[model samples]
Target: MASTSSNKSRCATCGKNIGTFTCRGCSQDFCLSHAQEHRQLLGKQMDEDVILMHDQFQQCLNEQVKQPSLHPLMKEINEWEKQSIEKIQLVAQVARQKVLNIISKHTDNVIIALTSIKEQLSRARDDDDFFESDINEWKENLEKLKTDLNTPKAITIKFDDKMNSFIPKISVHKERPITERFERFLGDIQIEENGQLITHGNSNAHATVRGKGEYSSGQRLFRFKIENKRTS
Candidate 1:
């Protein structure tokens, strides 16, 4: 009777108790047919997982391959940007130098012209002073001559031995013309420096007498040339 009862309690497929036959691999209790089916399902699930892992690994490798190719291009672009910046800076520096050079030249020319004018003005003042002194001396000499002529002295004066007649003669003439004296003064004038003289306007021809022995005939011609150039 116990054997009969045990037989009735076992699974029909595997001839074992329904709960006693458990698969160690899957940790599930089942009849033989159901166990076999469960193993098949597990194997299929593992295959799907392996395929998914292989696909993911392939994707990672593809990404790595693309990165190596792109890296050199990115580096080249960065290097080009650096070189472009350097070239722009160099061009700007060259332009700045050119502007500075032009300004320096302009300033130098202005200084030279100003110095020339200043020197010419100084010479003109000296010439004026010399002319004034000469005129004063000439006046003093004329006054002395007048005083000597007015003095009265009685004496027997004979024009000819037969005719006893006295005649008073007076003559007045400039010992030296002012124009000729001025020209002589201009000729005596000299320039200390080795620069040509420049005149301002066409009002009058004024001699620029620098000092004692520094005047030149070329300076006089240069002044005339300046006047003509300005008028033209």
Candidate 2:
């Protein structure tokens, strides 16, 4: 009876006796012409809705990329990394200069000493008669040179082969770890209608508002005051 009764339903749009199809959403019957018109109207509404959604989403993404309020930790950490690297570079430069200075000083001393020994040997060769005093002096000089060879000459800068192993081997970089943490947090932060956070299973996140009262998405997603920071 329900099926037979439904067959006799009137078109809601044209008020005609025969209906080609029934709309489940509005729960209304419509004639063929009205049904087609209704479908076209719905299709237009859907297109408009899709376009609006795409525009809003694109705007949101653009705002986040171009002018987002950068995280304080991220900025601070980047600065820290730059400063630390600069400091290390300065220290390395100082160390390198010191090494060069020591090498120059020690090399000059050794060269002068060798030159004096050479001159004394030439004089000894010229004088065939070996004076007892000269023989003793040359022997003493030779012994001194042998001792100098054993004595540590300004610690030669040979890097410890094992030093590389002792340096810190971090599995994750400083900013990289923070970025990974934020990436995981990204999944939890869902901006809902009117700039609200949507909470799902195990998500207990909250958005902090600074410098003012509550904001509503009237025209844009929310309202906020933007000011240029001035440094004195």
Q: Report clashes for each candidate as comma-separated counts.
A: 5, 0
Q: CA shift at 122, candidate 2, in angstroms? A: 0.8
In the range 178-218, model 2's lDDT, one tens digit per residue, is 11111123443443434333333344554333222333543
lDDT of each prediction vs. the true structure? 0.50, 0.59
10 residues in a row with least lDDT, candidate 1: 173-182
The true-versus-predicted C-alpha distance at residue 213 of model 2, in Å, is 79
Per-residue CA lDDT of candidate 1, range 1-232, in tens? 1223344345434666554345667555556566677678778888789878898988878876877655667789989889977876775576566545554554564566556555655776677544665556545645644453343111122223244424222222222211111122353243322434433344445555432233445332221223245343
For model 1 the local lDDT of residue 223 reads 19
Stretches off by above 4 angstroms in model 1 are 1-78, 126-232
Clashing pairs in 2: none
